[model samples]
Target: MSAKVMPDAKGRQVWIAAISKKSGYSEELVASVLEKHGIRPKVTAAVPQRLMVTSLSFTGKKLGATPPSDIDFGPKPMGPGLWAVTSQRNFRGKTSILNIIRWCLTGRQYIADVMTSWFTAVTLRFTLDDREFEVRLSNASEGTGELLKHARGNEFQLASFSNHVEFEAAMSDFFMEELGLQKIENHIEKDGKGIDQPHGWVWLFTAMWVEPRPSALFGVQMPGAMSARMMQMYLGFPWVNTTNEIKAAQSRFRVKAAQSHLVSSGIRATTEGRIASLAAQRADLQAKFADVSPNTARLKLAEASQRFVNADADLRAFVAKKQVAEDDFESAKMAYAEARRSSQAAKESAAAGYVFRAIRPVCCPSCDEVITEEAAESHLRDHTCVVCKTPDRKGDDEEDTERTLLLAENEAKEQLDAQTTRVRLITSQINEARLARAKASEQCATAEAEIADMTTVEENTVRIQILDAQIAELRNLNQAETEAEDGDSKVLAAAEVITKEMYEVEQGRVLKRVSDLTKEYAVTFGIENLQSVSIDGGVRMKLIKNGQPTFFSKCTDGEKARLKVAATLAMLKVSEDEGVGRHPGLLLIDSPGDNAMVSVDYENLVSGISTLSEELKTVQIILSAVSGPVILSHVPKARRIEAVGDDYLW
Candidate 1:
């Protein structure tokens, strides 16, 4: 714990932070531990890094340059806030402008969908930490294959790509250096699967930029719980995400487990029942061997063998008959009991009905309805109970009542009579069953006695030897199963516990920290009732407001827009404070005002974002929005752009 194993984020940091917040430990303790590990980051200068899309130029010719191109979108060098690429509703290539910036920086397929027409090349320039940078990529599908380069200052010198790989490397390296991003393994759950996928430092865009569709949530996949691993790494815990040791252990364990499976399958093919039967046969064979004289070739006389075969056949027939008798007796007993129970139930029901009809009450038993004397007097002709007005099965007339009671009694008596007949028949069958069982048993005993007395001439020495061999083979199989299967089982059990413990530690470090960070940003985004943010259990970006899960898909469009902004910005703020993130303070938010919010809420959200740029000076946010009533007002004259007549972004 003293030696910082990982600098940025660790179980120790979480524990210390927890203790520091409670038991009042000084931050020096945390700083000391952090110094022992991680990149041991140097102090960031007061001046912060900033990214802006300075200019975008497109030529109308393919590959090798031809016609002079027009400047599609260019924003004034507004140092921070946002390099807003606002456009009228027809998309006006506003997204295309943002995407082109994404393409140049990350080499992603920025404009592939919209780049249907010819464009000789697209050049882009931006400044990071006051140092200007440029990327002039050839829209050519051929030649160097990729247009990528790096240059600082006012000069736009050419640094062409040696190949696509080198181009990518250069881009990654430049950003890592500029944005303070470091190389580390980040565990991402691709496609919302629970397993963690470790991607290299280059795959960091999943967090650095915001996807246009905010509902999808976390890091290129559904709120990946492990995505916090990357967020933590960028937040200055670069060393925390490097898990080379566990990976090595996992690799070794897999090989051992596979071999264990092979041995286990072999053991499964043999059954305990077969082994027990073999043991019994082996004992019989041994006894036969003991009786056989080594000098004698055959033990059975031909005449005795014929007699023995006849006795065996008679014994088998007698045993079969005994089994049949026993089965029949059990079936008859069960049937008789069931009939008797049914008859008793019918009798009880008839008795209850008679009691209910014979009695008269002043008030209804149910619902407490009153039975006035006047109502009862009128009830005699209606054949209904005066209290509740339920029609009687028999009229209230003395004769009808008597007849109904008698009918119930007769029905009960008939059921009893039918059951009594069945019971008597079953009793007689039971007696017959016992007699048959006894007779069959006596005959079986006589046949068995005859079979035992009969002698045999057949030799059993070969069979005895075979039984011994089988028993030996089974013993070997049992031994193999014990050795391989048991060992494999133990190893897997231990591995599971170890992996779970490790995951728990990771959960403590990432889950809580991400939530805390996410909540802070959510508050900054004007989310008044933001409760907490959780990225645990593989449920990524779970927003709980007022202690309940806020479903992403179900939220009003406006909420989604605001929340998406909050969650993404939360990460940037985390990286800023933690000083361990590779976020590069770059946010590519397509639009912030497109959700189901009222115009006022949208204005507040836009205003909040505009204010945020000044608060977190190091971060870069590029927004693309349809030129709406609210958008034009907040966006600076220099940053906002409206598409004319037929102008589309693409």
Candidate 2:
């Protein structure tokens, strides 16, 4: 083993300020303990990757037309721009239009049974960066659909499939192909059991799009942890692989430790119960040790002699300890004498000041002037001294103060005397103990000599030996289990270190990018004091206004809407800036006006979307909103689809 331990390159348990302070453990001690148990984390550098979606469109056979009417998204390729599908009227199929596009990109449609019942042979055409592919799903309402795929220049290639499984797989493959997503395995723990499966498109879809909900604070519609994992994947970090591995290892260790605890508990119970039952067995063994018989088979002569000598040595050691204790007692006696002297001095000092005030001078000490008893009485309460006629103020001292001092002195003297007596008694006892210990030593020596002569042990003696061995084995087993428990504890500690370090070095980058970009976007959207946006585990979007995080619930409706838009857009902007975001810059925003936001803020939100579309050359936004002048004015008439008269989006 190397005297100097090196931190693993991938990851290692390093000194954590928070943990060390909370635990009251020194860095060196924590490190030493962790090293002793071989609990070191291995660090691996994450490689960057990026993917994005350019465009998405879909069309199906319409009623009353033998040939299908076209909803042309590709009259021209609108580069990095906004496309709006707006209708002020409720249930006019505006959401349905977005949902249909969503269903093609993802596999979920609005009321899948209902939508498929209404239309069949629906074809989805979308551009992924440069490649244009179309997938058509037919035979819905029967819980079955046929999926066909083709490029703009190529024929519909994949063979038609009528089952939901094949159709779903085809859709998943299409999105995965466009997003450059991998079907990596993820270990999931359910009911204390761990299982692994390839990450599905449902998880990825949460990152690609967000729908408006009256009560929801998060933009994504997935669980907090899942959303966070998806964001990481989109940011070019491999979350499914590393996080899943950590989770799996953690769960495995937890289950193993639990099992170990159960087994160890059983063993402990058995051992304790056995100890009670084996008392008679041990008593029999002790009797054999005391017995002297010709048929008794003795232990090896050399070992027996050594053990006997050790017994005598123990007695000798007791005698030596008693001698040391006796010497300590003598020193204590000397201290007692010194303490008595100190008490006497204290008593003298206690009365000296009082004596001066009590006893008056017949003559003045300063000037050799004789003072009569009448003069002394006058001096007790005089304004001036009689001898010198000098002004002075003196008062009579309290009576019986000397008596109080005397009583204290007496009490102190009694305590000192008692302590001295105790020391004397202890010394006498020590002498008796020394004599007793010497006699024991002599007896032990004689026994040792006799035992050395023995060459055989009795069967009863063998039973005693066997019992002793069994007891020792049980103790060893317990000790081993204790060490194993410690090892498990260290492993958990080290795993925490790995997670902390990974976030510090890797996740911090993504977070920082988001913070900076969200601030920039917030500024563009005219949100002042908004310094940044923070998505913690994708659970909540906190706006960092003037350096303090402002929660979503705390902000105004308009501010909330802007913050949400800023976060979603900023993530893509940051991804583009780093050239490593998996997001293809295609945004599908549902109901930007749902919050009934402030007029200026709502307009700003629309204008900000339009400006971003122009600034970010790689992004394409498909926005759905209610008919409002703020939205209609910002989006050009040609680019915007209005649901006035009979021209509904559906």
Give the C-alpha lDDT of model 2.
0.59
Clashes in each model (backbone N, CA, C under 3 Å)? 20, 17
Score each candidate by Cα lDDT: 0.55, 0.59
Predicted structure with the largest TM-score when compared to the true one:
2
**Tens-digit lDDT track for model 1 on 272-384?**
56566766866676665566434311223333344455545555655565566556555655655565566556557657776786577877777777787878776777867
lDDT tens string, model 2, 1-650? 00122355323434334335434565565555445433443333233232233334434444434574544332222445777878777666677767766666566655445346455445565656655555556554332444444465556665455665666677777667656565434445566554545566755665546555423333244432544555555665532334544444454566656766777788878877876667776565556555556532233334445554665565566566656655665666666566556656655765674555555667788877778878777766774565665545332332344455556556655665665566566556556555555665555565556655642345445655687688779879878877766654554455455444555455666676676677677777778877666666554667777888777768766666566667767877766665555665667777866766656766777898899888776777777888778777889887776688556565
TM-score of 2: 0.54
> Per-candidate TM vs. native?
0.49, 0.54
Instruction: List candidate 2 stretches off by more than 4 Å.
Output: 1-80, 142-152, 156-161, 173-199, 214-225, 238-241, 255-503, 506-510, 526-549, 556-558
Estimate candidate 1's alpha-carbon lDDT, on a 0 to 1 scale: 0.55
